[model samples]
Target: MSAMGILSYGLTLCFVLVTFYFLRRTFEEKKPLVFDGYYHPEFKPVADVFRQNLLNGKERGGSFAVFHKGQCVFNMWGGYADNEAVRPWDKSTLTMAFSASKGVAAVIVAKMVDLGYLDYKRPVADYWPEFGQKDKGNITVEMLLSHQAGLPLLDEYLHLRDIVDNPDKVERVLAAQGTVWPAGTDFGYHGVTYGLYVDTLVRKADPKGRDIARFFREEIAGPFELDTFINTPKSEYYRAARLYTQPMWEMLLETLMSTRYFPILGHYILFPDSLLVNVAKAVVEFTKDMSVFNNPDLREVPLTSATVTSTAEGLGKLYGILANGGTAENKVLLNAELVKKLATPLSQGTDSVIKQENSMFGPGTVIMKNPKGQLMFGHSGHGGQVGMADATNKVGFMYITNYISINGLGDDPRYLDLENALYKSLDNHESNIGNQNI
Candidate 1:
């Protein structure tokens, strides 16, 4: 045989062997998935659904936790944190909470308001003078938190470095930017800008001059003994979930073919802030391709609107505090007055920008109104994570997942199923209590 032909045959043999090795690894018998936290008997159906999803390749991995009357009643985690499924998600696993961190940030502010340190009705300019520039002087803290400031999109293009690392430069831009609408007339979801606004406001308003990151560590995370963080520390890198995006082509295909997938992207194009929405979409598209979310530098930097890392248990406990009237173990984190203020709605109906039906807001939290007019408050992240409190019932529940869906607002069925199951459990508990009382 010629020398060239011999080399070609050898290369082919090597390729086959490498392919076989990986195929074997992929099909290897998996260990039985287990959860570390205490599981409630009533939640068995929920757990079974999750287990089936994992087995059927419908889900990757995630965690769920719920608290009732200031105590954790259910905690469970399963599936792989990594896309490869080589590592199982355990008690120590932390995943990005994305927009849900807004709720946590709001809790911190509520604490300040409870202590009479910050006022919601006061103009943000009262605290940060530079923020008053460009006719933003009238924008109150409530307006900004409720996404009514009309500054949702950045006027200028911001590189990833600017968004992730440099807060000072971003502050300068915000100081000079004018609102798209009158300060409180309309509402929009401030996708990336909310964090900068909140952080800047919090830093200046804080008596200690502590930024959100510092304040969260010293006050909220430490005192509450929560595992959540606005900016994840480097030492905890090993525990953080490595994120994976569903293929862009797959998503685009669904948008084109599926009736259910159509409105999500369509709404962004049809909205009043379509230009801003397009620009924001472009920025997210740019980041997704580069694996920017997994960057160590990016993860460590505080982005109160996004980039929070926590276990379901941590978020659940935090919400549990809010559910139980903002007091945990007799330690008052948020007083009764502040709790009332936090529940106050800032908007009357569907948000103009977010297009969410009948959504309301109170500072940083999402106020969900039921048909009967009762309000349930909390926040949901970009993927499938949700942390919420039903204060009337004194219930807190959280669901976190690695499998990210395109529309996180209300489109993901997986999260909706879990939520329904949780509410059903709550109803059962309430009935039992009533029976016992009778």
Candidate 2:
């Protein structure tokens, strides 16, 4: 055959194969979207919203939980934990909450503050002397928590083993690093470095030398009986849900379509040395393979910025305490003054890394408003996972999923829909009570 004919044939064959693959995947038979759980009659709208999403194939295996007044008023779980639909998602199912772990770590820090072990306004150098190097003496604890320390990405690459095996070395590397921006003047998301820095801070601040993981396990999880873990145990590995991510083509399409991400893409292309590019490079260096998160070894490591494993009920109940003035079961987990500090905004502006505008951050938590415009505080993870506390209404909400969304730049619509339904239910319940009182 002629060379031109050969090239034409090769291209035609490749197109045929690609088309066939997409067709087969699109037409594959899917299991029924079956869910099981309990919802208070007053919150039936929340349950209905969940069921509709499952039925519409918008959600895979996941769970949702809400705690009001320190009680589990709504809890639900369903679908398959594995891609093959063999293992069912149940009450014990656990999934990686990604950056949502930061919120959990923030709660731990709040408890530390409440116990008088640490102070937000004090310089972080007070706790760890080495951190004062490179003109970081003025960087306060609140600045780090609020991502205003200007230490988002380190000049040197860091390995997970460096943190787990040689923490002192990691601390020294962080200490020697210079700020990317003028400290306390601007803010950026400390994607990979947040946990490394915070873990070191916890170690130095605690009299017992406990890291954030140990502190959370002993001080928060044990006392609260929550299933959340910064450092997951071996026995609980069996309950972990297998994560599924969108295809690269789908991700690229979504990024191009996203109003928020498109501008960031342009900025990255225009300015190679921009903070956004640096943060992206740092994240990529740490997470070479997104699928590595499913490995037991990664989960066992305490990545407080990510890799937190928990069920919906676990996060809901923990944030429930925060929603109800930091007390649960007649025990004070955090004093009212500390809770107020946590909810108060420490920084507000456009996030240099994510390019999100009008973002507000508290001490290690993202501050947002619910549909009703009531202030809510919590941290969202990489995928669609979220755990938030609505102190004004005393509601704690959590949603976890193994199926990762392609929308990386903004709030996932699935979560927003669920949250809107939850608030609507709350409004209806309150209205009914008010009518009864009248």
Candidate 3:
């Protein structure tokens, strides 16, 4: 062979070897960002499975936290916050935990009830007179929180511009829409509408006229030193997670067919004559573009029902307080009586909005049912985020992620695996609830 040809062949061989090395490294398991906790020896498998999930590339960016009796038992994070996988997810990374915001919003309202400013049995119109319009004067606060007020859908479509620029107009429209069913008759998931209602009611009921966003900041998030937020501040914007959008074909299929992800519009498109089709139509109009989640302006708007930025630790801490009878950091945040009410189930059965069976709801929270079919109070977000408090077990569990998934209604496999680990770990402790105020 000529000397020039030999040099070219050697160069090609070097290139192939380098490419192979990189490929092997890409397929290797990634180390978790943070893993700290004390679990029984038996719970090793739980940690192993969690690590295996990252190694298998099933997760992108996320965090999981478990608090037993106000003490953090397990806290773990892995993956990247950005879609480009350049930024490693860490203790500070935050994302929109979707419906988990509902649980936090409910906690604020429950505190209001504890302070004697609101009553679940009283008509919501008693505080906000305008809300009494359209024969809604009799809808009680409890009924609305329990997803039973029957005003889950809006009669008119809403643009994001309207929700951001002129919430009052949207509020007025909500006040005027008649309930699809009589108040307290049946139940349906209110989806995004509940947030608007709760926002309006909290502002009216608050003596200082603070809106839900402000109230949560001053009363809950700030006082508790939580990293969560209803309207994420500008300074924290850089730390927000950039979610991975689903494959185009999958998104289109879900947008056209699934009610859980697509909201009311998908259902209306699939079954126009079905019950609550108008609600679906309204949801479709509001969510006409899923790009809204990717917009930076989303952090500026306070969509408490679905758009609160939070971490697993933040969510778990909040739920841990609730699980410990509303006391955290030696502060009595909620009265025991009110805590009991929050834990009580207000509605159960097939949810009209999601079209799922055995779904349970409480005021401002999604009461999750375990594999055993027993209801535990908490909430799950649209992607794969979930936060739940088992008062009986004194366990507050949270899982947050950036790798968006479609199995939103407590069926996500990652959530199930973590949930199983949580249950098994419970056997290692006698009872942590007695000694700690957390």
Tens digit per residue, CA lDDT, model 1, 205-286:
8999887888988888899899888877888988988887655644454454446556657775677457445435423433
Q: Write the per-residue lDDT of candidate 3 for residues 360-425, one digit (tens) a residue.
A: 788878877665555678888777789888888777878898777665676667888878866766
Task: Compare the candidates by TM-score and give the number of the best one.
Answer: 2
Count steric clashes of candidate 1: 0
Which stretches of model 1 miss by more than 4 angstroms? Answer: 1-36, 163-165, 253-261, 267-273, 276-290, 369-374, 436-438
TM-score of each: 0.86, 0.91, 0.84
Enumerate residue pairs that collide in model 3. Answer: 264-280, 265-280
lDDT of 2 by residue, 1-438 (tens): 999998788567656656765775688677866699999899998888888888777787899999998889899988889877478888999998888888988898888898788999999999999999999999999999999999988787776766687777788789999998888999988987888888889989999998888898899899999998886666899999988886665555556657766677678799888776776444343445466677777667887888789999999998888999999988889998888887899999888776788988999998888888878898888778889988999999889998887543228878888888988899888898899999
- TM-score-wise, the better of 2 and 3 is 2
Candidates ranked by lDDT, best first? 2, 3, 1
Best candidate, lDDT: 2
TM-score of 3: 0.84
Q: Residue 245 of model 1: what lDDT? A: 68
Ordered list by TM-score, greatest first: 2, 1, 3
Clashes of each: 0, 0, 2
Q: By the lDDT metric, which is better: model 1 or model 3? A: 3
Of 2 and 3, the candidate ranking higher by lDDT: 2
Off by over 4 Å in 2: 1-26, 280-285, 408-410, 436-438
Residue-pair clashes, model 3 = 2
